[model samples]
Target: MVATFGEVVYESSRAFADDEEEECEAQTGLSFEVEHTSVAKSLLEKGSPAAGLVFCAFVGKVAVGFGDGFVNNKSGFDLLAEVCMVGQGENVVDIYLNRPKKKVVAQLYYGAKDKNNPVIFALFNTHGVPRFLANEIVSKVTEFIEVSNRILIFHSDTLAYYQSDERCEGKVFYVASSKYSRANIPSTAVPLAPPNVIGGIGAGVLMHGEMMDKPALLLANYGENELVDSISLQPFAAIVKQGAPDPSSFSLSQIFKQLELTISQSLKSNVNPVAISNLYI
Candidate 1:
């Protein structure tokens, strides 16, 4: 039988667990419960010829574009696509009906809590999703999930940073001065890092050497007067620092290794799992 809109799917967070033991425990990370129930069907059935899907998992938001149609065997990528399209936009909806045989591109954002259990606003764009949809997904995500006062969305070529104010109902304002680059970085280089404030220190894949010659793991701040410090990196600084083996070279393995170390450190430090979910995987 085909699944319909508003049907809750119980997913095993075990697939996202750290080890065999954790997987065995089968912890429930985030429930794929349907939201925006009022317009799910119509949105799927008639919104647009081009379908865009959005969904949340443990506070993480993901969006994908697929061809319109009724979906069958909604497992793996298909299920993921459907979840992302729900309540995504007025132009796109009803991703499940007549689902496409394949997905176009999927954009993901990782959400996390700091040491104090406050939400961390961070978006990671693995796939090249459009800026408009990315913004829309993040906005809707904040509405459904508890979020921090600040927000940052990172893509290969662009970075969107925002600060929220309680006085303004947690509305976010974009930071136009933040700079980022992916030029000359290998497509294999995965950009993953804990989200830091717009003008603060953080670590991730940054351009090193002259003319953006190579992709090197570096520690740097986003804005002027911001120190390149490890205060934001905390427990993972020592290990991640090792990944940058001088500015003259780039190693895909080393980069991934550093990411793994960061994730392990995060788990050990009791960092919110949701925050580190997309960092390594």
Candidate 2:
């Protein structure tokens, strides 16, 4: 049978958890496949695509993934987690990045471009995990997020970010958020926060991380909002300082400018009507 492109990428990431067939399937399920395919397709014009790959720890989220939130005030960090051709990168997947066969959703080489100066971040919403996988919805809280070094950085409310805990999902360490007022964030921007359960994917990832004794961080927006500014990327600034080889070399502003340009173009392409009333954002 000819495996679909989505299946190929899913399988690639799936390879990270080669043993636990049942548990793995239960966690990822068809839902993950659907989103996986949807995301892969979004990057393709029509056929198979895969340039190179290195299966590092995967950075993922269910719906409210970082692919959305942190609007307006942007992060000038010029380093963008540019998506790559990983859907059908057979040679890359089988050789370069996976020769050791480490179990992970995959991660960036951090400074692959210029290891000496290491500026660009090699990951983010890599067009495989859907922004809103069905199983991660509020109605599907029972299911746990799959195993792997999957970091959960989705959107959240200012309340949750400041509170340092999720109401339904249990106690969680609040990481960070975009700076914004209570009112809803901009359209292109996203109002972060798991739609439910302290964050559906967020909770699951935390649980899985605990089991591995390596809890992934939940870097999220300070509030459920979006934007057209550079402040949105402030939270990641902390990460840059921590993980980047040469922290000072980066600037959230550059990232904000790049995203701002791309997003502006995207916005112009769509037809969005203005809201007549603003009672509760």
Candidate 3:
């Protein structure tokens, strides 16, 4: 699936500070302050793992542009679209509906705990589904499955490019299978170190299990000159472990304080900065 994302990178602890900073700037209208903060004492410290974990939730509407739908293995036809949002918040929502003209979709939430959980989110087709009926399906999914906070757009991008429907294709179907792969890691297994995929920290997290057999550290997983979008990545474990100057002396509360302030301030000024999910996925 094709997914595009945007994010505002900021010091989570200074969210509110960023807000004040913006207000101060707007009031003064001074372009004097450097666009980027480089002071080590300030919360804008880069590459800090503890600084990265606070992804909060903000509500917004998604516009589903008209597009082709995908064919499914089931008796009925289905549509799929690829969408994603990489914001510095705990919750994100996906809005979907049969009729794009009439905005219809659901909200999904994510938090620090699931930082490393590979499953992004899941949703079912609810096109033509009544409001009450649609809600019931959503409720069931939330109750039974994790990542309920994530919004799932039914008939999304995956359906948009189905080759068979217009091509007189036959239906695709799913059958029960007792076969299992021995390589499958149990859900409880600790995630292996992240792989060094260029421009793919998120994807690396998503595919952690499969790539565990490989080295977890970027120095080992990636070659010297991999071309990733301007991310200055070091080894994953090293980064996480080296959160603060003194590895032995670290606190979650301190990190939270820094993140919360950063988000409020930066976002209040319409900056909408993105914070790294401190998740160790």
lDDT per model, in order? 0.25, 0.25, 0.23
* Per-prediction CA RMSD (Å): 20.5, 17.8, 24.0
53-114 per-residue lDDT for model 3 (tens digits)? 21111111011112212122211111111112223233333334323223333333222222
Give the residue spans of candidate 3 off by over 4 A.
1-116, 147-281
Against the true structure, what is each candidate's TM-score?
A: 0.22, 0.25, 0.19
The clash count for each model shown is 15, 38, 52
Candidate 1: stretches off by over 4 Å: 1-123, 147-232, 235-281
Q: List model 1 lDDT by residue over 178-250, tens digit each.
A: 1221121122223334223211112212211111333222222222111111222332223221222221232
Candidate 1's displacement at residue 90, Å, is 32
lDDT of 3: 0.23
Order by TM-score, highest first: 2, 1, 3
Poorly placed runs, candidate 2 (over 4 Å)? 1-58, 62-104, 109-111, 117-246, 271-281
Q: How many Å off is the CA of 183 in candidate 1?
A: 44
